[model samples]
Target: MMNNYNKEEIEKLRDLIKDIDTAMLTTSTPEGLLSRPMMTQEVEFDGDLWFFTMKDTDKYREILHDSEVNVSYAGKSYVSVSGKVEIVEDMDKKREYWNKAYEKMLDTSYDDPNLVLLKVNVRSAEYWETGSMTKNAVNLFKKMTGSDEKDPSDMNKTIKF
Candidate 1:
């Protein structure tokens, strides 16, 4: 299925999620479902989600066992993407997205010591956004006076995974 997000709403979601920086990465665990906050370098709405993680970590194992996962980011706007995860070892892709800070934090090069990439093919996603305070107040005022207002995110565009 596709997400029924409109162009304007899509732009709003992109703007919101891009700056959120951190996303809660979720996976199924025997104990139940597990989630961890991960830093996002870039999140493009081009049908796939890309992230980096240590290849030797527990999340990697869980993903291998079951690829179903969700990533969420929220700031002024909120977004949640659900799909399947794949461990990618593409050297070129890694090199393209690599950063010095990542190596500094992980204590190893991007290509070194069991580093792996998590790429998700988004099957579905949801987004919510709030308009400017001025706009919000006007809408509220109108509603209080018995007027209908257009929602900020009801664009009618399908969200591309």
Candidate 2:
């Protein structure tokens, strides 16, 4: 079951993932699940995530075959976002998200016809934030005393919008 997320909850989710740079993008392929590391675009999290990709790549083709995808991030917190993807070719949007570093990395100008954007319209997300050391120690003590069965470190929530 998914819970309807409020603005505060959405903001919390965004704050949790803001610092995490890369996300593992998982897609369905003929061989099975294929996961690739994609640099997360710095954008406001309003239920959509964007990444730069080439239209001719296998990842793009796989997304076309199966639009459902998962993007995962790990750090002090772990987040799993599942969504439907669409290939965007709008030049204005490209200019908005493009950066000088990308030019050096891709060896192509923003105007390159092959350059495309992957827009992931997030459906739902699950996040887990590990507790601090002190909290974990307290939870461990509680467990040892048989006072708590759940660990404080196991902080997780699922939200749908």
Candidate 3:
């Protein structure tokens, strides 16, 4: 169940992440697991993933009950990251995902009483990247030619993201 990926493939996965702006975060609660989609603008990935949320939200409470969580981001390409979610209440971090636009949208400062930042220390992730129609066609062509070459469409890379 392990296909070792190279540094180039690692970067490709990260690049796919750079394009998407939202993720559906699934959290485990005492009741059960629930999923909620949230804008990923506040997500700060420095090898260790970070995201902002409300302290009073159910997602936050669920994390408290069980740190185990799954965060998925996808579009043309897809990424599913499995890791532990921790609450980061640092003042400086509050100011990082904070912005004037965010204030306008949420009608509150980043330091608002309800605000919270969930840092996901991504340990490992799996991806299924079927790039585009052209890429798919190229993959088929490779198969037909018995090239056994990698086509961008059949990308399967796993990494810490």
User: Between prediction 1 and prediction 2, which has the larger lDDT?
Assistant: 2
Query: When superposed on Cα atoms, how far off is each prediction in RMSD?
Result: 4.7, 3.5, 5.5
lDDT (CA) per prediction:
0.76, 0.87, 0.74
Backbone clashes under 3 angstroms, per model: 2, 0, 0
Candidate 2, position 25, lDDT: 99
Report the C-alpha lDDT of model 3 over 24-91, residue by residue, as the tens digit.
88888777778888666545344446677877777787888889888788887788888887788888
In candidate 1, the residue pairs with backbone N, CA or C atoms under 3 Å apart (3 or more residues apart, or in different chains) clash, namely 6-157, 47-161
Worst 10 residues of 3 by lDDT: 1-10
**Looking at candidate 3, what is the lDDT of residue 93?**
81
Which lDDT tens digits does candidate 1 get at residues 50-80? 8888978899999999999998877776688
Better of 1 and 3 by lDDT: 1
Worst 10 residues of 1 by lDDT: 152-161
Order candidates by TM-score, high to low.
Answer: 2, 3, 1
Q: How close is candidate 1 to the true structure, as a TM-score?
A: 0.75
What is the alpha-carbon lDDT for the whole of candidate 3?
A: 0.74
